[model samples]
Target: MTILFHDTISDSHFPSTSHPEHPSRVQTAWKHLDGLGLTNACKKGIASPASLEQIARVHTDGTIKRAQETCARGGGYLDADTPVEPRSLSAALWGAGTGIAAVDQVLTGNDRNAFCLIRPPGHHATRSQSMGFCLFNNIAVAAQHAIDHHELRRVLIVDWDVHHGNGTQDIFYGDDRVLFFSMHRHPFYPGSGLSSETGTGDGLGYTVNLPIDVQRTGDEILSQFKQRLDRSAQAFEPELVLISAGFDAHHRDPIGGLRIDEEHFRHFLDFVLDVGDEYAGGKVVSMLEGGYNVGVLAECVADHVQGLLQRSLKTGSLKD
Candidate 1:
């Protein structure tokens, strides 16, 4: 369990007034992982600045430059929700860098998998805009990294965030090489993952969005997601898998209505690991995107990592 992150990703870099997407989110996760004795297992990775082309791999150049300049200009808002302070771009870029590091680590077998714990979630950032407290699409960039660098023909992104990963879907909307699946609260922020949006052109039927209704329990969510996961992986046979693991759907989260406990969240991770074992050669990378409640976020992330390691140990690759 090599957790990828850097102090550069701290709130000091991306100063904010009182935003929930602050760096404390990662801090909370670290506290819990440490309490669980998992911190020692983490192999810290440095998050270097990503090149314009690296970002352009998944985002439009105009959007990239604009975000860069917007952060450069000191302060502004991508929307009423996403705010940028002076250090916002560098901090946000660090988020993307965290994902990039995790992707490279997993692909090169530095670890069975890696969890990138960084702030300012990225699932809501689209190809051309940032929204829902997200700037750059961290998971999307990592998925593209797998496709381009690994020459992977098929890649699957499983977003379990309470909100739909609209940006991820939009990035691969019509691409056959990538399959995007999201289980989220419908009619929520950025609201575009209706079941009918299931891909287009060369990617028709490749995108699957399970817009679960509000008030759904984690157990119920996982059951439905399992069907989609089982079917989609068999159909796509992806060479790599990425997760947009957001804890905002947790029962205690102030935002969404999904009521999921730590056990259920761990179950979801186990389900993901099952799929990775079957089709991806145990290649899976996860990047944090959401989770505001410090207590719940910490516990949920710890449980998720514990589950991943448990499965790996069970399979004889990862030592407990």
Candidate 2:
């Protein structure tokens, strides 16, 4: 397993103690994993900040400049929910960079898979706007990297954050090379990802939205994921798999009302790994998105990383 992260994201600030998307979200998990020697056991490195040219793939130059100017002026809010400071811009760039590095690691055969520990959770920022506590769509940039840099025709993205990955779906909505699949809480924040919101143009039928209700059980959701993903993988025949891996659906999450727990997350990983094995030559990369309950989030991350290690061992690709 290869772990990519940035140490400087801690400088981003919301100035409100009530804000949920803080650096502690990943730090807690990193500390726990480190204490258990899990992090030390894996190959770890800091990712270089993505160049402006790389960011331009998913964001307009104006959007990039606006974010920089906002930070240059000592920071302010992009929307009612999202905030930015001097370090926030740097943090955002590194957030996207971690995902890019993860893809390179797996695709270059340096590792079977990789995980990105990032913050200011992305998947909400669009090509021209940054909102929903996200400055840029980290996963979208990484998916485009695989397509543009690696020339992969079919890439699979699985997002299980409690909220729909509206920005990601929007970016690839007209392109056929990428498949954006999301299982999120409907009638919730952002209020998108309806069953009818399929992709358009050359990308029709590539976007899969599973808007689960808060009433559904984790097992039920997991079962739906299995059936739907199996169907999609058969046709897409993805060469690479990317996960917009978010744990905010945990029952204890302040932002989400779902009842998912650690065990359920493990089950989700099982299905994701199976898909990678069957269609993607066992290559997968994951980017962190959302998870607020720090303790529960850390436990799930530990379990998730453990699963990655175990999977690599089983496939005889654990480079460490």
Across 223-270, the per-residue lDDT of candidate 1 in tens digits comes to 898888899889888788899999888878988748677777777788
lDDT by residue for model 2 over 1-320, one digit each (tens)? Answer: 54545464644644355678877887788898888787877778557778889989998888898888998998888889987777788888888888888888788865787778788778988888898999888999999999999999999999999999999988899888999999999889898999898899999999999999889998898898889888988989999999988999999988885878898899888789899988887898887889988998899888888888778767866344
The list of candidate 2 runs beyond 4 A from truth reads 4-15, 318-320
Query: Model 1: which ten-residue window has the lowest total lDDT?
Result: 311-320
Candidate 1 accuracy as TM-score: 0.94
Best by lDDT: 2
Give the worst 10-residue stretch by lDDT in candidate 2.
2-11
Top-TM-score candidate index:
2
